[model samples]
Target chain A: MELFIDITLLTFLCITALAITVIRKLFCAVMLAGIFSLLSACLFVSMDAVDVAFTEAAVGTGIATVLMLAALNLSHSREKCPPYQPLLALLVVCTTGAVLVYGTMDLPAFGDATAPIHHHVAPRYIEQSQQEIGPPNFVTSILASYRGYDTLAETVVIFTAGLSVVALLGIRDRRGGQSITTDRSAMKGYLVLRVVTKLLLPFIFLFALYVQFHGDYGPGGGFQAGVIFASGVIIHSLTLGRDRTLKAFPQRFLTILATAGVLLYGGTGLAAMVRGGNFLDYSVLGATALAGQHLGIFLVELGVGVTVFASMTLMYYAFSYRKEA
Target chain B: MDSIPMNVSGHFNYWVAIFLMMTGFYVVISRGNLIKKLIGLNLFSTSVFILYISLGKIHGATAPIASETFHLYSNPLPHVLILTAIVVGVATTAVGLALTARIYEQYGTIEEDEIRIKDESL
Candidate 1:
């Protein structure tokens, strides 16, 4: 039954991919890409990578669609035809595809228990995570506690990316808040959207918090939560205009928020170090190892959530501002 | 027929992933539009995501949710790695889109051929 579902989803995914490539209309292509993301997220769920599915759904389908649409708004709606025949591109792609297929020939059979992946560190994480990390979700335990440094780096990567966007396209209005209103009055036309969004915005934020806190028990974490949270703000901006949203989360405020989140994450590690433990050693933060793990994960996840939310929303602002400039 | 592996049925998922990957790569290289290229890049990374997630699956196992009754769990490492990868992927896309926007602003066109022409003329 699972294989049946997988095959069905894969079939749909293939069709979507083909449609996205064939569609010259960029708007339709963007929408098709959203469908592709939704299909992949379903595949992730079917495979029981619920955390991955959650992130894929939120980032891939939700925020990514919005960002893409915003980008589409800024650029031409239809894709330009290639000036050349693209025969070389086709040759290169076919050769790379052949090489990849040949490389996969030696891989272990699908779902094999004795595969090299399962033989190494994964078994220990699966078996010991409950006792050592005290999280019901081992993915969160591995991500937040066991391999905390990588998560920190991932957060910084996002921060840097967000910063680059800001640097490339300045989000600030130079004429003393005059430019935010450039797009404000236009938003009044969408009264129904504004009202509906106003009502739903609170619930969106509440759910983001739930997903943020529920990582240890279920299939969610800071990344998904942050995107969800930022999506809510983005929806507000989309519906009500950037001026009102910017007022609530000004450029300076968001920059500070992004930096502070990294600080909190790094500070937790520094605190742990000062307590005679290795960097990001959460066991030293609390009396018990489990308690320390819990506290440490919570803090870092919060940090991640804040950073993601600020950076994503700020990038949206930057992109939206650039749409006019 | 003899060249086909013994576990060909089991490897069907990888084949699908590879198909998508190749399609994405083809789109990336063939398309001249910057936005189209970014879309193709997204498709390629997503295919890679599927590849990793498929590899992490364990036959008849559930998600890596620790429990008393269930002993079998899919490999958590790939999922963990992919989670970070997804975030990074989106971040990269955002930056790419931002760059595309800047490119559009400066050149007034996002097609690679046109941009190249404009650059040469300048």
Candidate 2:
């Protein structure tokens, strides 16, 4: 029974991919993207990472669809490109696919129990996180503590992305030039949705906090929490008008958030150095080694979350607002 | 929660996701229309989301919600991460929509070829 379902869903996913390539209509392609996300989430549910699945469903299907639609609204539905040069595209696709497949052949079987990934470093994380960090979710511990530097780098990347968006697109002070393409009529179902979003935003922020704090004990940490935090603001944008969303999370404040996040991260590393540990070592945060690791990780996670949220928000804002001018 | 089902077959989902992602990326690079590019972007993103979510399913797990009687709950971690990803997607969509509206205004025609020609003539 289970194998049948897997094969069927797998087939559907493949079909969607093939169909997306052939589909000429932009709108259909965007809608298919939503379908793709939904299917991916279902696949995740089949895999065992419920957390990743939930995010896929939300970000992939919901927000990405909205973004694509917005982008579509920027242009015509039909592609203006000359008809597909089948031979060229096919060659490119085939070469790329062939190379990736060849790479996969050398990889261990997905989720194989005896895979080197599970044997070497992953096992230490799986077993030790419970004992050292007191977290049931080993992935979180690894992300937040064991591989803290990587997470830090990822956070910095987001912050840098935010800065890039600001530099590239937000250079002009176009608030005065902002024009309205959407009438009240085009945004019909928003009155009630706005109220609902207003209600939910606080809870969303709260949930972000919980995820950030609880990351040491369970699933999630800075990156996930940061995304959720940004999402709360996004929901506000969707419900209320774009203008209102802008007012709530003004561009200046977003820049500050991004800067603060990077500073916080860098500051944490500096603090660790001062505490007599190597950069980001986290072993000298306080008294016991465990205590230092825990405290250091927490502070860094907060920094990471804040930075990611700001960056993601800034990117969205830059893209959305630029077409206005 | 452990209610989420896993399969005995191979990791087919990831492959599909990767394929869609690559195709979408190709479209984005090759297409001239702005909207078509957006569509391709969606394809690319959705494929990655698929890849991420496909990592979470347990052999026999329920949803991630905490329940008293549930012994085999799927790992809540992936779901949490996915939730964040979802929010990012929403934000990206909102921005994309806004940009589209602006593009329509700036260029009158949304075709990339026309926009580029207009730009070059300027």
Candidate 3:
């Protein structure tokens, strides 16, 4: 039954890819890409990776679609025909594909119990995470506690990416006569949009907080929460225009939040160091080892959430600000 | 009729993943539009996500949620890794789209070949 479902989903995925490639209209392509993401999220769910599916659904389908739509508004909606067929690119791709397929031949079958991956440190995480990290959700404990440094680096990567976007296209202080305000009247007549969005915004924010604080027990974490928070802000910007949104979340505040979040994560590690324990070693945090892990994970998760939310809002501001100008 | 390769039949999901991956690669390389290329890149990464998730599945197990009554749970490691990958993919996509917007501003077109043509004349 699972095999059947997997095959069906993969088939849909293939069709979506083909459609995306054949479609000349960028708008249609973007929508198709959203479908593609949704399908992949379903596949993730069926594979019992609900945490991954949740992230995919939020980031891939929600924020990415919005960002791409914003980008589409800035540029032409139609893709141009290529001057000539890319024979060399085709050859390269085919060779690379062949090599990758050949490599997968030696990999363990889809779900063999005795697979090397199942035997490795993965078993330790599954077996001991409950006792050690105090989270029934092994994925979260592994991500937040066992692999703290990797998650920290991932947060920093997001911070850096957001920073690069701002540097690249951010509307700096007008050197000449370039205007930064988008037409506020763009959403002027949509009474329904404004009302509905207003009703939903607070709930979205509340959910983001839930996802942030509930990471240890559920299928959510800082990364998912931050993206959800940003989506709410993005929706408001869409309905209420950029100026009002900026008033609510000013550039300076967001910059500070982004920086402080990363600092908080690193600071937790430093605090542990000052206590004469290894860096990011949460065992020395509270009176008991489990208590320390809980406190440390909570703090770092907060850090990750804050940085992601601020960075996302900043990136959206950067994109839309330039689009308007 | 029984001549089908064992690896091909047993690891059919892997083959499908490879096919999806190759299609994405072809689109990325063959397309001239920056946005299209980004879409293709997404497809490619998603196939990889499937590949990894499939690797961690057990025949009769449920999600990795812990329970005292059940002994079988799917491997949680891939889920952790892929969650991070999904976020990273979106971040890169946003950055790439931002760059495309800037390119449009400077060169007045988003086609790779056109950008090259414009650059060569300068």
Candidate 4:
């Protein structure tokens, strides 16, 4: 049954990806890309990588589509024809794919338990992670506890990307606050959408918080939560006005929040060091190792959530602001 | 060599991933629009994610969440890696789109060929 579902989803994914390539209208292509991501997320679920599936659905399908649409608003919706034929590109792609397929010939059969990947560190993580990290979700335990340093670096990468966007497209209004009113006219006639969005905003935020804290027990974590929270804000901005949304989460506040999140994660590591442990050694933060691990994971996850939420919102603001100008 | 048998059906997932990767690669190199290139890049990255996740799957295993009934769980390392990759993917996409938007603003066109022509003339 699982294999059936997997094959079906992969087929749909292939169709969506092919459609995106063939479609010239940028809007339709972006929408098809969203479907592609959604189908891939379904595939992830079937593969038993539920945490990855959740993040893929939220970030890949949700935020990416919105960002593409905002970018589309700023640029041309139709693709221009290429001056030259794509024969070279096709040749290169075909050669690379053939080589990769040849490489895969030596790989173990699908779902083979004795595959080499499962032989090394994965066994220890699967067997003793519950005792060492205390998270029922092994992904969360490895992500937040065992491999905390890498997660910290990933958060910093996110921060850097947000900074790059801000640098490229200045978030501040150079013309002062005069342009606020012009951008304030949101979906004026969609009364039903406005009402529905208004009703659902609270639950979206509640779910973000739930996902943030429940990573230890389920298939969600700071990354998914942060995207969800940011999406809620983005939806509000779409239905209501960007100006109103900005009034609540001012650009200055979001910048500070984004920086603060990285600082918070690093500070947790520093605190661990101060307690006579290695950097990011959460086992020393509290009276017991388990307690310290839990505390450390909580703090870092909170940090990740904050940075992602603020960064995504800030990116949206940057893109939409450019569209208006 | 005779003892080993070809198992094409077992490697179907990898074949699908390779197909998707090539499709995205074709789109990226062939398309003239900057936005289209970004979309193709996204497709490529997502396919790589699928490849990694497929590598982690274990037969008869449940998700990595510890449970009383399920003794076996799929490998969690790939999940951790891909989770971070997904967030980073979106971050890079935003950066790419921002650059595309700025390019549109400066050159008044997002078509790569047009932008090159404009650049050469200047």
Candidate 5:
């Protein structure tokens, strides 16, 4: 019965994706993209990834659609295409698709327990993770301790993206604050929304805290929580306008946030270095080896969380503010 | 490579996901519209999500929640990863949307070719 359901949902998702692509109208395509996210989230639920399904439903289908709409409001939604000369492109795409399809034949059975990935490191991580780390959720251990380097690199990626936006658009506002087309009277609708956002802000932040620290006990973690917290700010910016949101988190302060996060990350490494261990060697944080490792990992994860959250939001803001110049 | 579905029956979902992903990629690369590119990017991201979820499946297994009786559950790690990926996806989409809107205001059209032309003319 579940198999039948999976097949149906999968079929619908594919169709929706293709429909979005073929549709000449851009707004329609963006709306269809939201539908696609919802469908994909449902597919995740079917696969028993409930946490993922939840995040997808909220973020992918919800916030992404809003952002896309805001962008669409500023531009034409139609494409300029030639009447012909598309045959060569079609041939190229087909060739690439054929090669990839051929490559999938040798892949392990979908979710096969016999697969080496399941048999080798995964089962060990799942079973022994508790003894190795106090974390009940294996995901937390993998992210914070085992594959710590990847998480760190991911943090750097977010920071770099923000810097790139700053480079592309620069920091100077051409007209300063007086040039916006809309005035204070236009913001009457935002009054109610602002109050609601204020109410939700604390809870959103609390949820982020729960996700970050409680990750060892549950499925939530730093990266996901950072984005959610960032969304709260994003939501405020959307309703209250970029100008008002800037007051809450000034553009100048974002650089400080970014720098602080990087420093925290580097500080952890410095702590490890002082303890006479290799970079990211958590055992060097204190005299007692196990205790030090624990302390070091926690500190590093916290730093990582801050950096990822701040930098990602900083980039988004820069992108939005690029027009001012 | 076989050009036939005769070899695999149950794995059909993967094939469809792949097709959608490739088609989306084609749109992203070939189409000159900004919104179309975002649509294509979303498609590509969804395909990857499907790939992750598919990996976490356990035939005849229950949800990953711990039960009193200790029944089997699907691996919840991929689900957690997907959760983070989904949020990032949404945030990215939001940023992309905001950019497109501003692009329209400045350039009046979302077409990549048009934007290039406008920039060149300026």
Candidate 6:
């Protein structure tokens, strides 16, 4: 049954990719990309990577679609056909695909228990994480405790991306330029969407909090939660207008929040170091090793959540803020 | 020679992944539009994520959450790596789109050939 489902989904994914390649209208291509992400998320669920599936669904399908649409709105929606046939590109792609296929011939069959990946190091995480890290979700334990440094670097990467977007598209300085006004008249006709979104905003926030805190027990963590929170803010901005949303979360505030998230993560490591533990070694953090691990993971996850939420919102602001063209 | 059918059937997932990877690669190199190129890059990265996740699957194993009722779990390592990768993927995409937006603003067209022509004229 799982194989059947997997085959079906992969077939659909192939069709979507092919369609996106052929589609001339960039709007339709963007929509197809959303469908592609959604299908991949479903595939992740079937493959037993629930946490990955959740993150892909929220980040890939939700935020990415919005960002692409905003970019499309700013620019052109139709793709100009290339002047020449892409024969050389097609030849390169075919050669690469053949090489990759040859490389995969040596790989173990799908779902084989004795595959090399399941043996080296993975077994330790699977069998010992519950006792060592106290998180039922092994992905969280491994992500937050076992490999804390990588997660920290990933957070910095996100922060850097946010900075790049801000640098490229300056967030309209309210003081110097024409102050952005909430066009209430423009949104008056969206009465149903406005009211529904207003009602759903609180619950969305509550769910994001739930995902953040409950990450240890289930298939969620800071990345997914932060994306979820940002999606809520994006929806609000879309419905209520960017100016109103900016009033609630100013550009400066978001920039600081993005920086502060990285600081908080690093600070947690520093605190651990001061306690005579190695940097990011949370075992030496609190009264007991387990307690300290929980506290450390909580703090760092909070940091990730804050940075991702801020960065995503900041990028949205940067993209949506149109200048005189 | 006798194992040819077995090999093909067993590694079906990997074949699909390679196909998707090539599809994205083709789009990235062939397309002239900057936005389309970015979309192709996204498809490429997402296919790589699929490849990694497929390698981590274990037959009959549940998700890598500790449960008293289930003893078998898929490898959690790939999930951790890919979770971070997905976020990173979006970050890179955002950066690429930002650059594309800037290009559109400055050059007035996102078509690669047109931008090059404008650059030459300047």
Compute the interface RMSD for each candidate structure: 1.0, 4.9, 1.4, 0.7, 3.2, 0.8
**Could you estimate the TM-score for every candidate?**
0.96, 0.76, 0.94, 0.97, 0.82, 0.97
Runs of candidate 4 with Cα error greater than 4 angstroms are: A173-183, B1-6
How far off is residue A251 in model 3, in Å?
1.0
- Per-residue CA lDDT of model 2 for A1-325, tens digit only, reads 6546666777887788778767878788777767877876676666666556545644663346555654565456665554446567657866886776565554443444443433455445544655676456655565566666766765665565566545655634454655544523124566677677778888989998898888655556676777777767766665665676776788888889888877887787899899778888777887877787777777887887788788777766765665565
Docking quality of model 3: it rates as medium
Please give, for residues B16-106, the per-residue lDDT of candidate 6 as tens digits.
9889999999999999999999999999998999999999999999999999999999999999999999998898899999998888989
Give the range where candidate 3 chain A is weakest over 10 consecutive residues by summed lDDT. Answer: A172-181
Off by over 4 Å in 6: A175-186, A323-325, B1-5
Error of 2 at A244 (Å): 3.5
Worst 10 residues of 6 chain B by lDDT: B1-10
After the best TM-score superposition of candidate 3, give how far the Cα of residue A167 lies from its true spot, in angstroms. Answer: 0.6
lDDT of 5 by residue, A52-104 (tens): 77566556643466556645544565667733366676777788888877776
lDDT of 3 by residue, B1-122 (tens): 23457555558778778878888898888898998888889889989998999899987888887878878999999898889888888888889999999999999999999999999999
Q: Write the per-residue lDDT of candidate 1 for residues A201-290, one digit (tens) a residue.
A: 999999999999999999899999999999998888878877778778888999999999999999999999998899999999999988
What is the C-alpha lDDT profile of model 4 across B24-45, one tens digit per residue? 9999999999999999999999
TM-score of chain A of each: 0.95, 0.85, 0.94, 0.96, 0.85, 0.96
Q: Write model 4 residue lDDT over A1-325, tens digit each, in one string.
A: 8887988898888898889888999999998998888889889999999999999988865689999999999889899886669898888998999999999988887798999999999999999988898999999999988899999999999999999998898876544655655655578789999999999999999999999999889989888999999999999999888887888889999999999999999999999999999999999999999999999999999999999999999999898887565
TM-score of 1: 0.96
lDDT of 2 at B23: 83
Tell me which of candidates 4 and 5 scores higher on TM-score: 4
Q: For model 5 chain A, where is the 10-residue window of minimal lDDT?
A: A179-188
Q: After superposing candidate 2, which stretches have Cα over 4 Å from the reference?
A: A1-5, A61-63, A95-110, A171-190, A323-325, B1-8, B11-18, B25-30, B34-122
Q: What TM-score did chain B of candidate 4 earn?
A: 0.94
Backbone clashes for every candidate come to 0, 44, 0, 0, 5, 0
Give lDDT tens digits, candidate 3, residues A2-22.
867977898898888888878
Query: Between prediction 3 and prediction 6, which has the larger lDDT?
Result: 6
